[model samples]
Target chain A: MLTSCTNAIILTVNGDEHMLVVEPNELLINVLRNELGLTGSKYGCGTGQCGACTVLIDGEPALACVTLAVACDGKEIVTIEGIARPDGGLHPIQEEFLGENAVQCGFCTPGMILMAGDLLKRNPHPTEPEIRHHIKGNICRCTGYNGIVRAIQHAAARMAEPAAADGPDLVKEAR
Target chain B: MKLESYVRPAGLEEALAVLAAPGPKALVFAGGTDLVPMMRKMRMNGTLLNGDSPRVILDLSKLDELCGIRKAGGMLEIGAATTMGVIAADPSVKKLVPVLAAAAASVGSPLVRNRATLGGNLVTASPSADTAPALLAAGAVVRLAGAEGGPRELPLSEFFVAYRKTALQPGEIVTHVLVPLAGRPVAGRFEKVGLRNADAISVVCAACEIELEGSTCRAARIGLGAVAAVPVRALAVEAALLGREITADVAAECARLVHEHISPIDDVRASAQYRGWVAEAVVARMITDTAREAGA
Candidate 1:
């Protein structure tokens, strides 16, 4: 019979590489939150339904709550913390979320922001329905999601025109 | 959940050897979307804790043999480990088997679909599996490899033995799903009635693939899900529509015959009566939509 054995895995998170020993059953959410001190990914429903524990695994959004850490060896992961600019500034999506009052309790903010970032990356100009469709996995109990949808639209507009002085003001028009 | 060991075999041969081992309960792990949640549930119920023997997880994500979509002869052979995201986005799948692509797209959200695999969806054997109905309607075949046998293929219709049970043997693992491509153009549609638009389990789902010459149905295959012990092909409905002209009345009559093939039970998602009603509605809509797409 196979016995319990700890496996050493290397995870590159937010462009930093770290080697850690994890159990076979250790989930990626626990490894990121508890072991690596990156708690941006929240553990909502341990099941795959709620996307609160979302993170980018190899450039694709995946639920970390159900992902085994050992299964992610040598994979590049980006968390909510990594969504910020390299210069320590908030991303456009984050800026729009704050500017649009998209956040209420902030429990689902990290996941929502990460999902928006992924959406904007894939589609620079997404319609309102596309934004809603892309972030369907994430659930926010506080905000009815109108603000979230508007914030994503504002971010898309801002990202499309980086040099425009009226980029941040697009949220007002969106509202 | 406590796992004794996890092994990511380097190749298919090594994976089969590990599965053939006499000791330890080995579970095939792919995508980990279903298995991880299932293990967590078992842990919550104290089932895994009470078990005396160790459990081994055989991870197949790294096996190259089980991870691609290719065309071989007349078949579109899709690797079992191919993710739903890939399947939904693949050009060949979208162009060839559109119903499968639509079904794959209607699975969980982008995050879930990125990690959830085609094999995991079918192997989990859930009655409401989004991809099962499309695959069954497409007349797909499952290829299995075991320690003893060289390799074997089974029709998707025969793969499911019972509720949450498959025909997989002790040492067998699903390697690929081969979908026979039709020589002629076929119109297909997949409909899934979930509680919400996204990330909701299906109350009733149906897939229809119809070959039409003008308004006459040359051939038809109908698969239904979430309204049976396992995903089932609506054989009676297919037979009824074989040579009939696909009109609204014909579609409605064929839909009414779907109840004879499905035995849905009341669960948290829906009641059996609701499923029956929804099944008829969805089946009728799918048939009508597919026939219309076929220019019937």
Candidate 2:
């Protein structure tokens, strides 16, 4: 249990920073799930073997299990919930994931989200094999990889289209 | 371990001073994915778990002493702290050191690789360590910083004498790894035998590097992992492959030499006989793969 008696932890999540006095040995996953209540990331294996605990550390996906809360001091951490805009608009990846029905067990979704975000950041247009290979580190037991792959493609197609609004929302809101 | 006290030193010198202090128990933290769990599990070699553990936990991740990759002379000096993603994505590494790049890509997966360090791979020194054979096959060198001051260099081949053993003295720490550039990385292949397509520990792995001119082999080096107490080169295989034409018959003959040099043990991942057999096949594959590089 982290107490006020110990050192204060400073976390910059979703472009917002928070300070807390956490246990010296608290895990980043725990800090996010418990203290910050940013529980989008799931904990599958406390050991680093499983990618279920992955989160973006400085814009790169990192295993949250082995990462200590104190280690993240002065570092930026982005969780799955943080992917959406401040106005509650989903990032294209998340929207595509929902549109493609990519979520299953919901356990590995956060890790997959982080990994997919990482892939698109590095390569906007990745082949199926490349996408598979990129997310190979992430394990989804519910395993909607086919849907997940489609979601990525769907997201890519949507992103490829100009964002000037297409079908329903544009005309109705224009009035 | 329930870290008793965590101290993020202002610099490397302060960290080392804390580490070097007599009886001031400490564990260096980098990626912590391994150390933290092992400590948390109470299986850690030193330091107490969640109890009396360390007066301070030194986070080496802050130390810039071990990061990045750069062109150095004819070889590429990959900073020990450099992430696996950097290695896989680097154009120079992909073009020149494809084996290393591939091995990097093949490590635990993207998320794990992004945090795992090559220095940690060598320092941890597990027989099933995925990156060891690749480093050995590259004929890379490790630089260690010790209590004595200036850093020392050791060929990766001689670094690991046995399972979980390294030449580092009590206070020595691995600072960097120098992987030779491609086309000159000794012409090697890192073939791993594991349970899954990815994230599985190696069952029996081998990396073979050979320098062949036309039909004749010039120099040869073979590093086999998860077969013995330590990762070792199959000397008999090396001798058999060198100064000879690369052929299936010769490769078959070289493959059979596995029993003569390797000392595999039966374990959960595989049986002794199976490990030896996999070693043979892995070696054979390496020879053929190197043979295809006639144009490389």
Candidate 3:
């Protein structure tokens, strides 16, 4: 009975390990927001298609709203809150987004920024079409996307500059 | 989101062992893209039968067994857990099975593709699914596995028995999809009409695979989605184009047959008449593009 009653979910968010006891009906988004106090992620549609709930699972951007909390045991997870360094320095993507003026009232900004970060991590210098293609699932109700596109392009340049210097060796394999 | 029980196994063997036990206690998971939304559906019919409080939540994330792509004998072998983003960007699939890549690239968005798996799409078995029509045209096959036995396979066309239905047994899960590789020498295209674009379900869609040999119509296969209860092949058009000379007249003939072959109904996204017209127009356009790609 002791072995049979084992229940544990291990999560490592932004290199931080978290152990949780989750309800069978709990979602990753709800757990992150309600339990762990990481509420930077938004819940727009409660559906997977909307990128509002996007988070990185095993270093890959995933929809957290639809993800079951129990499914993330001993796996790496990342949310909008984790994008910044502990010293209060912003990630290159965050700096680029602010510099390029990609935020507007910014309800969708958290998801947008994280999704862009995920895309740049995978492809440092994505084409215009590729940039659009990558963010297609993350919708923006305000600022009508000019700023988002600009932000993505700006981040891509910064990301690609490093990769260009180090070449393919600098490129981390996508999970 | 609250769950009663959650189980994460290091791999498939461990996960399957926990799932094999008999109880209303468990539900298996993947991208969670579709399942999470279904739980919150406002008007969508049929919720996941696992109930609100499953005793077992088996997380299969550690199973690397169901990821990646392979090519052999002119067939594209796609792992069940292979993300749509990976498939869309894979150069091999782009060059050989471009239709699949095109369909993959068109799915939801980059974030979705980063997590959405091809196996998840086919397993969900929505009649309007974007990739289904493309895979159907490519002569795709489905491979499945269970706790007890060896892997088994089935034709992708037959995998969808009906609307919101599948041929998968309760204990089994899909493992992969095999689609024939069509080189540049051939012609094919996929077109879908959705509510808006980017993450909308198809109101109507069509896919065609064709070949042109020396100005003569060598062969063709057509697949339609959301125009019926299950995605159906355009046998009428396929029959009409076989051995026929490439011409505007041939496209018109194929378009005519396309109308007769499909049975679309009025739904929230579109009317039956609009679906019929779009089906015809899409068939004609696909033929035009395919023949043009053939360089004649």
Fnat of each prediction, in sequence: 0.66, 0.61, 0.70
Question: Order the candidates by DockQ, highest first — what do you get?
Answer: 1, 2, 3
Compared with the true structure, what per-residue lDDT tens digits does model 1 show for residues B37-110? 87886666634432423478889876799998999979999999999999999999998899999999999888
Weakest lDDT window of 10 consecutive positions for candidate 2 chain A: A166-175
Question: Candidates' TM-scores?
Answer: 0.94, 0.90, 0.86
Model 2: residues with Cα > 4 Å off, grouped in runs: A1-6, A164-175, B9-12, B43-55, B73-75, B180-186
> Model-by-model lDDT, in order?
0.87, 0.76, 0.75
Residue-by-residue lDDT tens digits, candidate 2, B71-126 = 88767888776777778788877766666776777677777787887777777777
Candidate 3 runs further than 4 Å off: A1-6, A99-101, A126-128, A155-175, B1-4, B7-21, B40-55, B72-74, B147-150, B181-185
Candidate 3 chain A lDDT trough over 10 residues, lowest sum: A166-175
Error of 3 at B173 (Å): 2.2
Give the per-residue lDDT of model 3 (tens digit) for B1-296. Answer: 33345565666666656766776635566676776676555124423632334445565544677788988666778888888889998987787777788888777777777777888888887778778888888878998887788778898877888777888876677877887665543578988788886777788777888887787777887888888888888888888888877677679777888876678899889998999888888888888788888765
Chain B TM-scores per candidate, in order, are 0.96, 0.89, 0.89
lDDT for B177 (candidate 2): 83
List runs of model 1 lying over 4 Å from the truth: A1-4, A162-175, B44-54
Q: At residue B178, what lDDT does model 2 achieve?
A: 81
